[model samples]
Each structure stands twice: as structure tokens, then as C-alpha cells.
Target: MNSPPHPPRQALPTHGTTLTPQAFRTLQAMALGGLLVLVLGWFYSPLRIWSNLLVVAYYLVTLALGGALFLALTYVTGAGWHVAFRRIPEAMASLVPKTGIAILVVLALRMNQYGWQLHAGAPEGTDAGTYWFKQLWLDPPFWMARAAIYVLLWSVLALSLVAFSRRQDRLNPQELPRAIGSMKWSVRLSALFLVVYSITFSLASVDWIMALEPMWFSTMWGVYQFAGMIQATLAAIVIVGLLLRRPGRLLYGIFRTDHLHDLGKLLLGFSCFWMYIWFSQFMLIWYTNIPEETSYYIARMHGPWGPVVLVSVLLNWIIPFFVLLPKPCKRSEHVMMKVAVVVLIGRWVDLTVMVFPSTVGKLPVLGIWEISGACCMIGIFGLLFFKALTKSAPAPKNDPYYGESLSYHCS
Candidate 1:
């Protein structure tokens, strides 16, 4: 059968746009308010402040990392439809350096809780060989070194790719030779980033999160972290895209219903993927009945934590799956935006469940510290993301696939 005809390419404005003054002021206020709130939390409860900071730091880092991963995946797959919306992910990825700094600050403040003291002494009755291995591997200095390496590698790769793309944007649109060469370099760097990310991100997850409960181990933990990361990243992209679609905005008219549909489909798929990983980890532990492993879930599944877990499942998977299952809903900006907001909240809840159980235990204290810390991170991330967005065009106008992306339509 013949392929469906491509829609006529739409004309986008030639000049690049920046965030409006009103929006900039709003974000500035949020940043300042969140900072003040965080300070209050710090003075009120240092432990809670640090714990929430850990959650915020890891969550923001994953979003930035996942944004880079999204770009790499699109390049590897040669996805033309994403070209028109590529700037959102690129800008999000640009926050990597900032996130790395935030993570380091959190670690420095809370080094005592993150496997530092445990390396000094081994558990009784454990084999000397195995104990030494844990001690060496989990040493604070080694952990810090690995984190620094991961951050440096990710920042360099992410910035390099964005720089290449931006350079092409600055060139004449007729400069196909240079643009194509730049695109090829982006693809090559993307491949390298993906390979490095697969290992380093897994180790980072184990170090930053799983190490909190050093006794608990799940073979699927890394993949589990990856699943949430992608889901959350997609949601952030969707939210930003919707915001940019408003009248008189830079991205207005660039993204249509089909783009929203594509994004919703991804959100739905990853929601299920995250749930599958969650269940797989849970089932294995429940089935094996291993005390070491089950203790992790028991802490989360019992007491006040149990309801939070159930709500997380509903918010992350059930709501998005059911809501986006319908074609019309996926295409509706209103519906998908709401679903994205819910999924984003669910992502935070999921992170809370993971971090708090190990740090705060069953007390279930959700107060100013949690609220203010989250606000602080969101404000900071928003500021960085918007600042980066202003540094380049809203879309890659010189991209080889620009026309194809503009003309994309579902069959």
C-alpha cells in the first residue's frame, strides 16, 4: 500500500524567542521563595532537610540525565518527528552541571548517612573477604570519586551535543554540508553517552539511593531507577511543551495534537514499564522471603508508608494508563497535561517512598521540610531550564529533519 501523504510543512518564525519578562519574574519569585522556605526547614529540622534534599537532588539529576538520554535515543533511532520539539530536551539536559553541584552539596552535608561510617567497621560473623570487598567498594572517598567522574562525563557529553546542534543553528540554513557533519558528530557522541550512561547511571543509583539501606539489594534496582527517570523526564517535557503552546509563545503552533499524542503514548508506555519493574522487584523479594531484601519493602509496605505506596501506583501507572489509553485523550492537550502533572507528582511520591523509608523510617512526617525542599529544587530546576532555553532557538531550524518533523502526522 502507498504511504499516507505528509502534511504540508508549517512556517515557523525566523527569529528566536526568549522567555517573556512576566514569566521570568514569576520564576525568579519562585526561586527566592523556595530558597527562603528551604532555609526555614534547615533551621527547623536538619535531618529532615538533608533527607529531602537527597530526594530533590537525585530526582533533579535523573530528569537532567534522562533529558540527555532522550536526545541520544532520538538520534540513535533517527526519529524525525522529534526535531521540531528537540529544544525542550536539550535545554533540560543543560541542567546537568547544576544538578551535579546540587548533589555534591547534599552529599557533603549528609556524608554521615551515606555509607561513610559503615565502611569503617564490618558486621560480625561476616566473611573477612566479603567484608573487605564491601569496605573497599563502599569507601566514602571511592564513592565521591565515582560520583565526580559520572557528573563530569555526563556534563561534557551533554554540553558537547547541545553545542554542536547550536553551532549548526548559527550557520546558514543552506549549509547542508556543515549541518549534516554536525548531525553525524551528535549521533556518534550520543552513542558514546548511552554506553557510558548505562553503567554509570546504574552505579549512581546504587550508590546514591540503594546504598541508603546498604543491606538491601535488588538486581533490578538500576533498571527501576531508569524507568522512573524516563517517565518523569517525559512528563516534564510534556508540561514544558504545553506551556510553550500558549498564544504569543515561542513554540506556539509548532506542536500539534499529534505531537501531544506521541508524548502521551510514551508517558503511558513508561508508566507501565516502571510499574512492571516495581512489581518484579517486589514479587521476587516477596517470593524469596529473604530478610535482607524483604526488609526494604517491609519498611515501605507497612505502617503509614503503605498508603503512600498504593497512591504512587495509582498516580504513576493506573491514572496515566487508563487516561491515555484512549486516542482522543492522548491527543487532547488538556487531558494529557493533567495526566502529566499527576505522573510528575507520583514520581516525587515514588522518590519519597524510596528515600524516606531508609532515612526517616515509619514516622510519616510530611511537613514544611518536604514541601519547601521540593519547592526549592523545582524552582532551581525551572530557573536553569528556562535560562538554557533562552540560549538557543526554540527548535533546530537548521536540522536536516526540520521539514519532515513539521509535516509529521499519524497515519
Candidate 2:
């Protein structure tokens, strides 16, 4: 028998488009349901609701930052391989401003949820020095001011990057010189943003999450958060790339398996990095046997929290680490898709472990409230991301590296 002829290839769009109606409606329901849940959860359990919202806000912000940060890294290093799918990260970064608003709202309304805020000026006890320091370091106005600065700075830089990239997309082939200039500007801005993001994000982690237990401190907290952020980011990129590769999608034939394999490598590497940070933090605390330091772990590693911690490790590190180790797995879209989902879920679980123990109690709590809050954030993120994605070409055809990116392959 003669071999069957290949099916005709579908034409792809050169520019972005609106979300399908079904997608829009689905995201709409998720957002509405989340709002309803928040309202109901508020009445049912006030503190719990607030705590969940805090988790959602922080989680959303970090994910958005991860997108922008990923873009900055690619730009600074002159990585051309990502240019074909750059719009996805650009859309992700677009969420920074929106999430910034959510975070500010959470901080403003639920400022007292944090231990530092609650006991900022409480009567001094045995640890008078510590109390005094909390009073100074955790000052509410100062804290809010710093948060505002972070939001403003991050929003401006992230938006500028997106804006510049979009502008470059409008250029024609003959405008290559101008496109090169834009790329140069992107590199300079990316470098500045990287330095600024490093210091600000570290302080932000300390202020927002680490300050949850005022008496406990870990020097490794920032790096730990960074690892998780980048890991999830890589997984997210892989997921989006795979999704876009679906038939009739923007990246139908543009985003290839080679890109997927490289992304898998990143996912695997960062999964290991996340585990490293987790162990380093745990080992140092266990070794020192210091009350202040151990107190943080005591809450998390004991009681109902113990199992949750275990689950977090398995989901965040163990699963992704082994799943993507094989060369074939990385190139298989199905395998990579599932692993990416696991890593993203693991990220949420990790965040839950970090936020809840500090806010709720030693025992773990999961209910409609937490679920609803997450749904709301995810829904909003999808909507905003799609909106941003539609505002420009799905890929940068005018970038100097666009051709190189399209032909990118791993030996």
C-alpha cells in the first residue's frame, strides 16, 4: 500500500487575537464565583477569608513578577530563543500592575492580620528589645509606603518593557535599525530592573511573608522564594508554549519541541534548586537549635502542618525533578504539560504552607474559601493576560533575533 499523503498545514496568525468566547465565559464564571466565595467566606470566617486573600494576592504578584523577571533575564543575556513566544511572558508581566492593585488592597484592609502589625506597639515583655525593633521596623506607615514604592516601581518597569516590545512589533523589516535600538534600550532597562528587582523583591519577601512571624527570621527566605518563582515561571512558559502549539493556535508550528526540551531542562534545574534552598534553610535551623529560628520550623514541621510540608516537597520538587529527568519526557508535550501543571500546583501548595502557618495556625486549613480565592486570582490573571496578549502580535516578527528564534534547535 502507498503511504498516505500528509494533511495540509493550517495557516497561523501573524498577530494576537481576542480570547475565544468559551474561554472568556469560563474565566468570567471563575471570577464571579471567587467574588461570591470571598463575600461568603468573609461572613463565615473573617480571619480565614482575609488570610486566603493575602495568599492569593501575594501568589498572583509573584507569578506576575516571575513573568517580567523571566523577560528581563532573556533580554539582558541576549537570549534569542524566546523571542518567538515572548508575547506570553509579556502578557504575564502585564499582570503586575493589576496584581499590584490587589496586593495594596489586601495590605490596606488587612494590615492587622500580620503579627507585627498586631503587636507593633503592645506593652513590652521580656523581649523588650525585639518589641522595640518590631515597632521601628514594622512601622505601618513606613511598611505601606515601601509597598507602594514596590508596586509603583515594578509596574513602571514591567509596563515599560511590555510597551517597548509592543512598539518594536509594529516595525517593518526595513525598520531593522530602529528595532535594534529598541532592543538595546530593552537590554539597558532590563539590567536596571534586575538590580532593582533583586533588592526590592528580597525586602518585599521579608516585609510581606517573613514578617508574618516577627520573632523568626531566615536569611534564606528571599532566595527560597526566588527559586520557587523561577521554577513555576519555567513551568508556566512550557505550558503556554504547548497550549499555543495546539492546532489553529498562534504558535501552532512556531514553538517547537526543541523549545519545550530547553524549558524542561529549566524546570528540572530549578526544581532541584528549590529543594536545595528548602534543605539548606531546614538544616541550618535544625543545626543551630536556636529558639527564634527553630520556632518558625517548629510551627511548620510539627502538628497538622507536618503532612502539608511533606506534600509540598513532593509536589514542588520530587515530582518535577524525576518526571523531567528523561530526555524523551522533556520533548513530549503530553508529559511536559502534566509536569508543568504539577509544578504550578506545587507552587500554590508551597505558598499555602508559607502563608497559612504564619496566619492561621499550626493545624492546616483548606476549604471553599481558599479554593475560591485562588480561583478568583487565577481567573483574573487569565483574563488580564489574554487582554494584554491580544493587544500585540503573538510573536515579535521585527525583533533582530526573531529569525534566529524561529530556527532555534538543541543538538
- CA deviation > 4 Å runs, candidate 1: 1-11, 15-20, 116-120, 124-129
Q: Write the per-residue lDDT of candidate 2 for residues 1-411, one digit (tens) a residue.
A: 221221223344554334568988999899889979898878887778888888888888988999999999999998998887898889889889989989999888877555544463554333666666676777788888999999999999999999999999677768878999998999999999999999999989888888887767889999999998999888888887777766666676677777787788889999999999999999999998977679888898878899989998999899988888888888888899999999988998998898888878877988888889888977877788777777777778788897787665664
lDDT of 2: 0.84
What tens-digit string does per-residue lDDT give for candidate 1 at 1-411? 222232344555534355677877777787678778777778877777788888889999999988899999999888889888899999988889889888988887877687654655766543466566666777788888888998999999988878888887888756777888888889999999999999999998998999887656788999999999999999999998888866567777676666777888899999999999999999999999977678888898878899999999999999999998988888777898899999999999999999988888787778777877777777788889988887887878889998777776753
Q: What is the C-alpha local distance difference test score of each model?
A: 0.84, 0.84
TM-scores vs. true structure, each candidate: 0.94, 0.94
How far is each candidate from the true structure, as Cα RMSD in Å? 2.8, 3.2
